[model samples]
Target chain A: MAAATRPPNRPPTREIDEQTDIGEVYMRSLLRAQLRRGLTVLAVVALFLAALPLLFTVEPRLASVRILTVPLPWLLLGVTIYPLLLAASWWLVRAAERTERDFAELVERN
Target chain B: MVSTDTAAWPAVLSVILVAVATLGVGAVGLRLSRTTSDFYVASRMIGPRWNASAICGEYLSAASFLGVAGLVLTFGVDILWYPVGYTAGYLVLLALVAAPLRRSGAYTLPDFAEIRLASRTVRRLASMLVVGIGWLYLLPQFQGAGLALRTVTGAPRWVGALVVGVVVMLNVVAGGMRSVTFVQAFQFWLKLTAIAVPVLILAVAWQSDGAPDPSRPQPPTVREATTVRVPDTVRLRVDEAVPVTMRGTLDGVRVDGPVVLETGRRVVEGGSEVTLPAGSVVPHVESVRAADGATWSQPLAGAGGRDHPTYRLYSLLLALFFGTMGLPHVLVRFYTNPDGRAARRTTLVVIGLLGAFYVFTPFYGAMGRIYAPDLLLTGRTDAVVLLLPSRMLPEPWATGVSMLLVAGAFAAFLSTSSGLTVSVAGVLSQDLLRGRLRSTVRGFRLGAVLAVAVPIVLSFATLRTSLADTVGLAFAVAASTFCPLLVLGIWWRGLTKAGAVAGLVVGGSLASGAVLWTIVFGARFTDAATSVGSSPGLLGALLAQPAAWTVPTAFAVMVGVSLLTRRSVPKSVGRTMVRLHTPERLVLDRGPSRREP
Candidate 1:
């Protein structure tokens, strides 16, 4: 690994072909935007938790908070939200990385 | 204790096929284990998809397969919280810990300790605690194997324990993390397929039979109490009651083994359990209306009545809810991926695999609801999934399902025990013998032996608690110790060396002592007076679940200590912070060799 007179940060910015790779650029930008707002990500999560009970299955008897009724909404929050969290985390990171690197490069090139 | 109704050949053949396939994966991994990184951390080269599968294999252990199903069957709706919390653990893991830990570039918890605290003593204590908890958790996997093998094949219980122990040792010794990675990855799919196939078959069978008689409404439950000549002075409470079939009666009474019990009590020894007509009343039996508007199928003792203690519920949830973040096997998975993002992605994948798997647990319990509801009576509710295949299908069809479950159970046991063994060995090697021994190879061997010894002993020693309960104990300990470390370490900049040392020592010791107290001597003081205020007192006792208070206290102590000694903070803090927040590709070498602040 030879040293390349390294800058402060590097984003994967080499253009393969301007006409062909425009889609890639836009997709990366969208991913990058989502990852940048960590506070918003957490806020939406808090909101989702507050709102999910309204979305419980229509069986009122089963939806009852009583022990016998098999509470469904808690199960959805407890079991199902995990994968979504993971996916959100991933999207946030790749997006966060792109943004951080770009900002660092902007500073370095200045 | 009874012969399986299904043919044994398919179960045997599939178990053999899985074993062979797993061994083949290990052998392939062996060929790839040429370097230090490959030996210890799979060279940090694995991608998200493959690593995610391996994480699932290791993560969904005996606790998931047998414990959750049994818990739901015995406790009804409230117990689904176990799986709920177990999976939610990853949500906590992702939200706080995963990315930064990976970015920290440490190999094990001890490594993390050494780097963060810059204290060798702190690192050593953390390593011992990791080994202690890993071995404690592995016991249940071994015990589950024994239970599974005996249940499935009528093989001796020791045979299953020995089988898992040997397989895990061989895999770890042969290729360290590399072999286990491949083996665990394959087992995840095999395990998923194992449970998924049976669940689908059973669901289709139920559909064919018109959906479990949901319209029948629960029958009027009955409990029969004849003065059975008491056998011994010690009374036994079945943790939860299920219908039982008995053969003999005491005091010259005509012994009818198949009668139902309306018993809402926590423990029942042995009795008859059959659904009777709702309106009909037998002369000898006492009728009890289902409590709390829930009916049975045998009424789950806890949810079906207002009778159960809330303290037990709090204890159980405490053990599971915070316990997840502390596990050795789960934490090790985070390190296998190439970067924090990968760790986060893999965790997400695990959530899908685990969530989909958990959705089927209630179905297994519900099957016990229909076909083999007898298991609940036998007080072997944990065996619901195992006994399920036999109860639902006709003799031959049921046999195939039973074998599928047995194979899946063994996979659960082997994958988890092996993963736990690897982490334990890594910690043991890196800390205990790391500096003492000049050669890494020698340290690996010692760690391997140390890892297998304690768990095998504990697996044999534990007799009172169900394997699931013991596993819960382990989770509680983990929640207390490591969960605090990871969560606080990632988010807080002010956590100091003295604080981490204090937390791991204070937190780890208390949690472990609580577990040991319950298992070893607590039952002896029985009125059974383990937690009844005689010794540790119920609440004041070393509650096995530590995170309820310890996690927060640990975090507070660390911060408080750091602030008090603000001038003593490490010079590397700025660099470490930078490294953690920086993207992986920005760094020149992927090695967490020198962290950037």
Candidate 2:
């Protein structure tokens, strides 16, 4: 199917064309809002992950865990999964959209 | 909790269900797998929801099923990094490789290797490595299935392993990627429902059952050892433990522990439990108890504090954290989506699914603290989830539930193993026999056998490292190899074939060496450095991960060499990069002509 393009509710493209250095001006203005929102989400996720240990009941009494009577903290830590995923997913979405938008703009202008 | 009369029929039945479903799915997918594109990339048309479901099924393998909960049970709270890494790995994939790699007009890693650098030699080397890594990753999946079944139904270990291998091989050979996608999507729902239903039931049961009797207690924790709460049936270790009575809490859940510990070491876990020795006195454990003044509604184990803090553990963790972006199975999922935007959405869904599932893993691990505390002594924490079903639910129903879980878990392992295998095989067939094989059938045949044999051999040999560690190591190596490849391949205009080779060789060698070292060290001793180093494979990859270091390192080396010999640069380099990132509608000659609607 032809790509979907429902532009945001704002002044039409014909109005923006009137400005001097309008093409670079308009494109930068277009990308600015999205970049800011994406960065905000990123910062929030990072803060949340940093704060997780405080909320948990992991007031560590001992450090060593046993595997066949072997110390297991090394093994156990590898599987700490939930937070990292949330961060990665958040990061991936932002990057994908950014890359796509940047490339599409470059192509349209040329 | 084992009622002695384990007829093995339940376990066998579960395997049969998985096999039937796999066969059915593969057969159906085969009808769609008529063309080369369909067999390789599902015609590059899978939508977000369907692909997301399939990715979930394929991603949540033995590691997520048995290993995650087991780690939580053994190590306390520190192990949450794994599921997070696994899910986030996709994020890395989306950002680094997804759109461009899909745009590369190639089907497999080896195919990418040859196209980017135009080197037959590099393709062969990558093909060999892909098989090696694919097999290394597959062994744990097979071993996990065997472990799951053995714990759940007392079936012989090999039965579980052999059955999954056969099932996966059939699925792959019959339908290839097209078939696997359907099977995996279904498996994801099955596996999700399998775990989700039990967790809900257990939560309700735990709330209504009231706190474990507050009198007698078991080992590891101080508690009333008089009462027990098993969400599933597994062997309890209280019969032979020098019960350590103490109080504990997991994620703020107050678990009054008169825990029957065989020893003081209860954290940094590789999943251990107290098992009854034959000569020892207590045959069957009666019940465990809760403590007085335990305020929390549900009591859980306390997380362990800093063990011998190591720079190495941090590095290993860094490798896993950043390295997930490099995993092939995960990267393949991103390609399965329609575009970069869809890839991002799917990643969000995956994070939700993965995180919610992780929240409940600790509960299963904590339940093991009471009912089948003996699992520790067996040195197989990975089997804890498979065993939990029977211990929590009542007879026939418990067995049936456990049987279903083992099947689902097995499907998880089989699907992931085959998926990786298919990717590697695609690389091998294209690189080694691109022109020589002469037919797609020949390529598929060679790839299929290579996929099955390597992992089966590794599984049979009993690699010393744990399943989670091996997988982490794989992530690390993947990060090292592909992390640089994707970042440099997409962003930099100056990247040369020489640089790509250097980054891949240096990063891959270091990561592979770490795997070898960890395997060797794991067999002899559990010394602190050696214990963590046993899986330095990923850490080595981490040193190379952002490829910021390795890519530049590679770029510098390539430029110096390329400057020294400028004639070797390929004419197609500019065109290739342009094709890789350009929008589909803009291109005059649309790529991947083999794809059909």
Candidate 3:
């Protein structure tokens, strides 16, 4: 019975075993990090977008305001929103990859 | 309007050029693709940039290419939400679904259903929904192509639909997803250039013309003696008396002489011609509420003029935001990435690419409002994108630019149709043709034919709805059904097979039923119908944009049913959860290894 239950000579080849307890920890942390980053970005962007309708409603004059000869709503929705989304996504992608890399490092060290 | 004699050759040539380009690119990719994996998911070796380009290519259908500018031109600032919501959807996808879905290692949404629930019943339900949503989505592409061709060349509407149908079928059956990716990626750049260069030239022309604001009290007028032809009987609402040369039939009276169009509406018969004097105010279609410069330029103050404006705005926002993730073609593209991380990166790049492309559309729309305002009278505002360049520029340049735009428009149709065909075919071949077709390729080929055929038949039977409106309905259906499934399937652990099926059936039926009603009887529920009662018609408004309620109901049913069937949860839920959330670096003998041992 002792011989039958003897430990394997080789160490676990893969850094993370998803079925095991430690693997679950690694997965949960990575997911938490990702979720946190995603939520942060989502909240900021959503608030910004949601506020546009409110601003137009509350101060109807805001729509007509011309900044550099362009209508306010046109500038906001048409020109600026695209770049803002691109910037936010770029930052989110960088942060997500960083979190994954750190998790990979932690697993490798273990 | 430019005569068909002059316009037909260039437009036809552009269409042929686009078809050849697409076929050539697809053929090249077919030669490169030698295995089943390549046909389905491009062997999971696509880089982030190329994948993102391909996604944008497929995602920017006729709606993005033509309908957006047209909507913006007609409705002003409120319509900008279409482009905004469209781009922002990827952000939501990136944040929530991107990585996890790729990590799930499912080739299709149905595959994801099977993998997560370990139930064939859920898979079958998903397969039906996928095919349904795909058919609904494909209907608009074919219709838009028909409209574009008929508007450009005097070809019968069916000719355009048939051409696109044949080209897309050939590409899809020949190479499947592998060919589609390259074709779509190339089309994206081509579409970008087509719109961008003309926009630049038109902007310069507009600046030269003193950048006249279209929102002035004076309505749009013809610059030249233009003879307008009505293909179908239409009601023209005149705000003031206007003298015009009438031919064929007007208000059922046949007269080939000058007549006065007084205030209020008059019917123009099919195959009739009316010539308006230069500087005469363009007559407005009864369906589109005529807006002056001030109202046209203002936000939410135009055609859908201020009644339940908030509800309409939020409903549309909800549909576009959530609906994108549920699009079968979009989801299938995620399966092409090697791992979850690559998928996330691809989504990030996609947001950037899509954002860049969206900026050009609104510019064209604003320009079209100024340059091609006659479309308002025709109620074919969707043609504004194609017409603006020719209207503004000089002869040869106009023809050249028009050709470019037409080619880009065709590319939009081909790329999107091909993508839709591959996805629908993937589901059809897998689910319906199982055990019958000896080879997967043969099944897929047959599936492609079925996918394109249904939409082609529907396109002929239906009246041409506004391109964006038709596409929006498809989005509503997708949002109501698959959005709930994906969000719950990824995030929730207790999602049972019974709950999924119930949610799918309930949500899918309600939204699609609303869509069918809208498509069939929508023309009768115009603005005039709302004036019959003091109170707004709640049913018509609800049916018009059903996503706000339908999506929530789906989520509620899914969650509630899931709770009731807790005991029915698959035992492998724990393992599935770990596999989904974990990074690709994590290795466990959950099943067959992706890499060879």
Candidate 4:
């Protein structure tokens, strides 16, 4: 509470350990940032996956088109999608670790 | 389908070698695992790369080893979604549950439930569901073993299941999680080599054959005169009548000469042998349609003869994408990582490893279309991977490659079965039998026996379905129940204990009910299609693929129930969230119950 004393010389980590109001704010902000990253990745995956069936359905003829003699659907779903998944996950891990590093810096600044 | 040559000996030899090697690897790690932490989670010291390999080793079951290719051989391109859904599931885990779950410091799913909600009831419910999902997943591994052994060595179905069950039980009881980790990582490399080498050889053989296109718009014809011996009574449909030399009873009449097969559904008695001339169309088993090459190669062309292929595909995807984190074995592997960052790194590498493994399955399916078309008639398309090597190469090479493939298939069975058994036994020992036993190790050993015993019995009793389909049902159940729990438990603070209980009950019952219905009725419906219909109606389709509806409903119920019971929210939620979200570097006063009891 604003009326409470500053608890002189107490560190921010102690506030978190004690579960003070300010500690809740710090945790909430970090969770929100992480949640945003997670949801963004999820939305991108959901859209890409959903649109694939739609593409094949609306344009059945595209199935016949071949790149390097492999069918489009086979190339897209069977082979290429895996590397794409790996890439997306790699990018996400980096972004998340960076967010955590920033949060660690903020919490320990005091 | 029977191989009488001396080559079958090598295949049998390879299986024995793999089994011995598995136990040997576990024995080497035996001394390292002494404490309860070592037994449960390898003391949380497994490095990222080793953990990733162990995860993949455990994750790629009989379904990935055999079923994916078989589906592709019979159904076509749409079935590729199985591998995609499988690999992408880890991506979702990496982005969402992997790091936070590791940070939660829970050894099992039930442990996580009790830690987050502080409720005994929720933990009990989660333990039951963990046992349920683990058993469901294990059933397919045993059946796949039977199928593989039969294909390679002419053994009866039960022999393979019994062998794998006994091996896995011994390993888990002896070494626990630490030894199993080393064995699994070793098996992953073994399996990759076993499958990848044969694929390369087959690819070269195809090239030398001028790389014939497999997508021709006609029924695949045998390049040479092929003799197919029916192991079981099969009802098959011949699209075009052809004269064939036969040596068995046809239409219940004894005939041993050239006869023109009629162009409708005919029931061939078991032990009948039919020899078709070169360049003749392959008659398809009743369960699958006789699809031309174009239809087989195209996506969503109704290649598998199912009523609603599109609905099934999407539903399968939904279940897999959300289900990976909910797997007890999978979550247990994450706990072996030292921290949240290592967990994320391990998951990322896992996605890549899985992707690399999956890239070869579709190749087997396509090659099977050309080289092993007789599998279509026998309706044992799941044997495509095992049989392709024999069909594609000459005698010596064929025998040798076939041996390697059978060994790889066995590796798939052993690694996955052991992983599932350990996780299930962990839960059992910790929660179910905690009061009865004095020492943790004795309890875990007893728990391992019970865990493997039930699934082994069920594998013998239940009718055999395709490996991928049975595994898919497991994912669906997990997706409906634990997916909601993990996602909400880690990310949301408002999730009350009552809400978690309500969601698990609703989601668990609905998804598992659909699974039970599909397993019992779906097999019978396929076998006796004339009695019911060619395809299941809308209700049957909905039950066949329940994840599309059940997952969302579970999420909704959890959120709604939590809001209504706002007053009952755990007072420690903020502290729990801090532990879950903050970086591991920032030491905080975690509660006394940080470790599993």
For every model in order, the fraction of real contacts preserved is 0.11, 0.30, 0.56, 0.78
Q: Highest DockQ, which number? A: 4
Off by over 4 Å in 4: A1-10, B1-6, B248-257, B528-535
> lDDT of candidate 4 vs native?
0.87
Per-model DockQ: 0.11, 0.16, 0.47, 0.74
Candidate 2 residue lDDT tens string, B199-285: 777666555656342111333331222222222222222333454323333123343544444422222122222223222223221
Please write out the lDDT profile of model 1 over residues B219-267, one tens digit for every residue: 3222222122111122233232334443444223344566443433322
Q: Docking quality tier of candidate 2?
A: incorrect
lDDT of 1 at B435: 85
**Which 10-residue window of candidate 2 chain B scores lowest in summed lDDT?**
B290-299
Relative to the true structure, candidate 3 has a C-alpha RMSD (angstroms) of 3.6
Give the per-residue lDDT digits (tens) of candidate 2, residues A26-99. 43443343344444554554455444433333643222334543223323333343555566566657655665
List, residue by residue over B146-177, the lDDT tens digit for candidate 4. Answer: 87887788788788999999999999999999
Off by over 4 Å in 1: A1-95, A98-103, B1-10, B213-323, B435-438, B521-544, B587-597
Q: What's the candidate order when arranged by decreasing TM-score?
A: 4, 3, 1, 2
Q: lDDT (0-100) at residue B210 of candidate 2?
A: 66
Report the Cα RMSD per candidate: 8.2, 10.4, 3.6, 2.5
> What is the lDDT, from 0 to 100, of the residue B222 in candidate 3?
68
- Number of the top TM-score candidate: 4
What TM value does model 4 have? 0.96
Across A1-110, the per-residue lDDT of candidate 1 in tens digits comes to 34666643433332211212532453344333433365466556545643443333233444444333334443454356666655655665565556656744632341
